[model samples]
Target: MTAVPEEQPAWRQRAVERSTRAAKLRAEQRVQRFLDAAQELIAEKRTTDFTVQEVVDRSKQSLRSFYQHFDGKHELLLALFEDALSKSAAEIRETAGSQSDPLQALRLAVEMLFEQSLSNPGVERPLFSDFALQLLVKHPAQVATAHLPLHQVFTELVEQAEDAGVIPAGKPRRQASILMQTVMFVAQGNGVPAGSHAAAVSAEEVWQFCLGGLSGVPVRN
Candidate 1:
């Protein structure tokens, strides 16, 4: 509890600041290295194809350091997918919440879907395609896995529409499912040529189409 001195030396203060900054920079660099390694490995093959050691080597970091940032491979892959979903959800939440009209909210939600697909190409390739297929096909038990928080956001949007009388009063879950399928189809509709209409279609176009379906004349409510 004794004070070291009335005033610290300038050089010592500078050294302390430099050390703190360096530590922060190192942490940031390590995260980037980890993500870069993940992207490189995922590009080459599926999730099952890569190991912790391979990721560390690709990152040019020690295995111990990799463990410092992540508990294990499962944790890392979950983190990667969750991060992408979180970003997309933020945009969707903002778009959906800010709009007064239910149709606008639906449009924004759809737009968020396409935007997420485009922004995170690396994730879209694995999670939306292969990982999703594997979880549904090879591992039915896995399909019952915890609902991604992002999906909850989508469900909430459906609930809002139902309350607003934009959608049918009953079967909110079914309505949400239909909307989810439409978004998924458009987002995962790859393989089309660049010049084609669907290929050229913007996120806005997807949003408009979805909004039309949700708000069609004969209100189901």
Candidate 2:
């Protein structure tokens, strides 16, 4: 018969648990450092062409730590992208939630999105140019997952609008999706040439077009 192992004391067990928790916290800090370094490089270079080694160097973390946390560069980028969009979704939701009118809430959300895309070209440019497009093409499912938070916010606004009779009684979620796509298309024009007509489009114009579509009215110039 195999010998029975001795049980750990309660105090010892509690100490072990505390050690594990501390280790997990440190690991999370290391992961965040890697992410922050990668974001800094992307902003500085205005592209996502940098390497994992570069991120490691910038983060002051080891290669082993990065690999331990992430599979590789693509995985890191995906994490960073998800984190960013999630934060943006939260901010937009908060802002929209403050508005009394559903239509105004929706408009404010769209305007904020457009403004972010334009104002923070350093981060937004690389995100939209490389990571987002690549994910859309190769990992459409991941794209949908990453975009879910923002989509949900829009859907909620659309539902509110429909309930308030500001929009027609139809598929609110589908309408929200269409509106999101429309806004993103126009916002992505931030990557266009500075003097081009596409680049000339403003957030107000985008909002006006979306409002017109939502209300079934022709947009006036």
Candidate 3:
């Protein structure tokens, strides 16, 4: 046999490495596909009877592949919660940071949250599928963890406003907790009951309500 060139072996090695990398990438994609499919189903229908097999079928991935990525349905649900929190937190940071005025930033942040709740009604549906409801019913720790980022951002903004003499300095944590609670109450469809349908509040309404409660006036225009 003719001697194989060194470059040929090196090229084969690179090809093998690439194939391994592609496998890993595909694995990651499958994991995300499952998560996306689960969220879509949960968003469209009820999560009361959702199952891992359902997710696998929706994602077009094998059940074995699903287990390779997640421990079980509970684990997958927790992952979904964490993913939602991460996405919401990132959006909050970006929207809030873009506003120079602290109060306006806070309002915008709240509005963005309201919009998200509306868009993902199944996830945030006041009586249907409260984000906090599931956590309170199944996993309190997850709910507590989810509040951390919201609390942090709210506390920071409150403290900053205090420093600027925009709002009276007091207990930031207490204030943030109250704000979160109020938002949840509104999101949970507790504001009022409409005929056959529940009252759906808009982001502007939430922003105004929060502003009023905090004694914060919307920045001019």
Candidate number achieving the greatest lDDT relative to the actual structure: 2
Q: Which candidate would rank higher by TM-score, 2 or 3?
A: 2
Per-residue CA lDDT of model 1 for 52-140, tens digit only, reads 99889998999989889887876566555555566666767887899898756866786767656642334443244545544455445
Predicted candidate 3, C-alpha RMSD: 7.4
After the best TM-score superposition of candidate 1, give how far the Cα of residue 25 lies from its true spot, in angstroms: 15
TM-score of 1: 0.59
Best by TM-score: 2
Tell me the deviation in Å of residue 108 in model 1. 0.5
- List the candidate 1 regions with Cα displacement exceeding 4 Å: 1-36, 40-51, 64-75, 118-130, 135-147, 191-205, 208-221
Structure candidate 3, residue pairs in collision: 126-188
| Candidate number that wins on TM-score, 1 or 2 | 2
TM-score of each: 0.59, 0.86, 0.71
Clashes of each: 0, 0, 1
* Residues forming the 10-long window of minimal summed lDDT in candidate 1: 119-128
Candidate 3 residue-pair clash tally: 1
lDDT of each residue in 69-171, candidate 2, tens digit only: 9989988988887887788899999999999999899999988877765535375432445567787887788777888998899999989998999888778
True lDDT of residue 34, candidate 1: 87
